[model samples]
Target: MEHPAALAGPPIGWRDLDRVLVVRPDNLGDVLMAGPALRALRHAAPGARLDLLAAPAGAAAALLLPEIDAVLTCSVSWQEAGSRDVPVAADLDLVDRIGHGGYQAVVILTSFSQSPWPAGYLCRLAGVPVRVGMSKEFGGAGLTHWVPSPPDELHQVDRSLHLLERVAVPPFGGRLHARVPPGAVRAARVLLGDRGPYALILPGASCPARRYPAGRFARVAGRLASSGLRVVVAGTAKEAPVVAEAAGDVPGAVILAGELDVPALAATVAGARVVVCNNSGGAHLAAALGTPVVVLFAGTEQVGQYLPRFVPASVLTVPTGCAPCRQFTCPYALECLDLPPERVAAEAVRLAARGPVRTSAWSSVREPG
Candidate 1:
C-alpha cells in the first residue's frame, strides 16, 4: 500500500494539500482541546476541504467547530477497547471509504503517550499520499513524516498545537470553541429561570478514577446554595443517581442530569458564573465557553497536562506519594481524590466574583423540533 512519493520535490508541501483528513478518535475533552489546532489547519489551507475523524462522543463536539467541513466517527480499539467488536470487514470498509475520500494528505493527532503510528498506517492503507504523525519510538514504516512528540509535559491544547506547528501550521490565539444549538439558549433559559450567579456542579467523570465522591459534591452544592448562588448539578442520564445525591434537597439547587444535549450543556455552562467539576468533559466545555472553573484534580492523570488552560480555572488536588499514576483503577482506593469540600467551595466563590457573563457568540445551525 506504500505509494512512493513522486521524485518531483519534497515529500509534501502545505500549499499543495487541497483536501485533508485529520484523525482524532478520542473523547469529548480531547477533541475540544484540539480545537485551536484544527482551526490552525483550516486557516493554513483555507481552500482545503478539512475533515475530522472523531469518536461518537467526540463527534458531537467536533461538529460544533466551524473549521470542520465534515466529520467521520470511529472508536479506536486503543482508546475505547471493547466498545466496538466489529470484524475485520468493517475496518477494511472504512479504509476503502477513506481511500475514496480523495484526500491528498492525512494527519493523525494523538496524545503524547499514545502512538499515532497505527492511525498513520491506516491512512497509508487508504492510499493517502502524505501521512503525518508524532512518534518518538517507532514510526519508520507507519508515517511519511515521523515528527518527534514534545518531550516535556504541556497542556493538552499546547500539545495538539505543537503537533500542528511541527507540520507547518501557523499559530493562532489558543482559544477553545464549540457551537451552541439554536434551541440551547431557550432551553437553558427555561431551566435557569432568572437565576443570578448560578454555579454548575458536574458530579461525574467518564471513569471512576476521575470522579470525586458524590457526598463531597453534595456538600459543595449545599455550600454554594448557602452562599446565595444557585447550584445546578449536571451529568449524563446514567449519572442521575450521582447528580441527585449532590443536589439533595439543597435550597435553590436544580438537578439537571440527563436534561440537555451537548450544545444545550455548552449553553448552560456559558451562562454559569463558575463550573465546579472533576477533571471531565464539562470542565473542557466550560473552558470553550470562556467560563471560570474549579477543577477537582483526581489522581488518575497529571494535573498540569490535562487541566483546562484556555480559561480561568482553580485546580484542587491532594498531594499524594503515588499521584499522577494515570491508572484507571487505583490500588490504594483513591486516597488522593479526597479533598475538603470547603476548599473547593471557597475557590468556586472566588471565581464566581466575575459574575454571570451571559452573552455568547455560539450561533446554532438548526433548532430541535
Candidate 2:
C-alpha cells in the first residue's frame, strides 16, 4: 500500500460549495480523530457552511469542536453482508433526510475495512454535486472524486486528514482541540469544588479486552490518593459501577460517572492534572483537550491506530508473543493487561510526577505483562 504522504499536494477548488456535509457516522474517538480534517476543511473553504453527520453518542464530542457549524444525528442502520436487507421505509427516510439538507459537497471518512458504500449511495441520491471519499469501495465508484484510504497501521486522525490531501488541502500544524463552553466549565467547577488538582481514571473501553482489571484500577486510585493527588473516576452511565468500584475507599477519590454531558466532560478532562485511561473514547477526549494521558493498551489492538498522539503521553503495552492480534475477543484469557496492582499504581504515580513521558524511549523499554 502506498503512503498518504506520497500523495500529498495542493488543494482542489470547488466552484459553488455553499453547504458541505462531513460524514463520520461512528464512535466518539472516530469523530474526534476527524477533528483535524474538519478544521482543514473549514480553513480551505471559509465561506462554505459545514455540518457534521454523526451518531448520537458521538454528537457531544462533535458539539465541542469549534470548527463544525452544526451536527445532524444520523440514525440509519444497515446490516452486515450476511444479514437481511434493511426495510424500505428506513432507507427512504434516510434518503429523504440527506436530500432535505441540500449539501453541495460531501466528505465521507471511514475505516479501511468499513466501506462507505451506503453513505456514498445516500450522498449521490441526495444530489450532492461533488462527493469525495476514499476510492476503495465499489460503491465509491459513484462518487464525484475519490482518494485511496490509508493503510491499517496509520493513525486514524492522520488518515482522515490525508483524505483532504488528495483534494490539495494543505496541512497547517493541525492539533486536536476540544472546547469547553463557559457554562460547562462553571458546571465542572461546581461538581468538583475545592478538590484541588485531581487525576482522572477512566476504566471503560468499547471493547472488553482493551479494559484493564477494575480491581487493579481501584488499587491504583488508592495509591494515587495516598500520594496526595485526588483521583476522580469518570465514565458514562453504562460504566458507572465500574468507576465507582475502581474508586473504592479512597478518601479524595470520587466517581463522576453519570454526572457529566459531553461539554462538561470535556471541561473536566481539560482541568485534570493527569488522565489514566484505556484505549477508549475518553483517552481520545483527554488528548483533544491537551491533557496528559497514561493510556493502557492490551494485546487486542494496534498501538499506532488507537494510542494517544500527543507529545506528553505514555502508552503502556504488555507484549505477549501473540501481541497486536487486533481481535475483539481474545482467544486466550486477557493476560496482557494483568499487571500487578502495585505496579500499575506505581506507574500512575510516575506519570503524574514526571509530567508527560515521550514514546521515544518506548522502543527501548521492555513490554510489561
Which candidate comes out best when scored by lDDT? Answer: 1
Q: Estimate, for each residue in 236-296, the C-alpha lDDT of model 1 and write its tens digit.
A: 9999999999887898688888888787788888778889998988899888877899999
Misplaced by over 4 Å in model 1 are 1-11, 82-86, 356-369
The superposed Cα distance between candidate 2 and the true structure at residue 186, in angstroms, equals 1.1
- Among all windows of 10 consecutive residues in model 2, the one with the lowest summed lDDT is 359-368
Clashes of 2: 3
Error of 1 at 134 (Å): 0.3
Look at candidate 2 and tell me the lDDT of residue 310.
Answer: 61
lDDT of 1 at 22: 89
Top-TM-score candidate index: 1
**Candidate 2 ranges beyond 4 A from true positions:** 1-12, 78-86, 135-140, 321-326, 355-369
| Model 1: how far residue 236 lies from native, Å | 0.6
Superposition error at 72 for model 1 (Å): 0.6
User: lDDT score, residue 77, model 1?
Assistant: 55
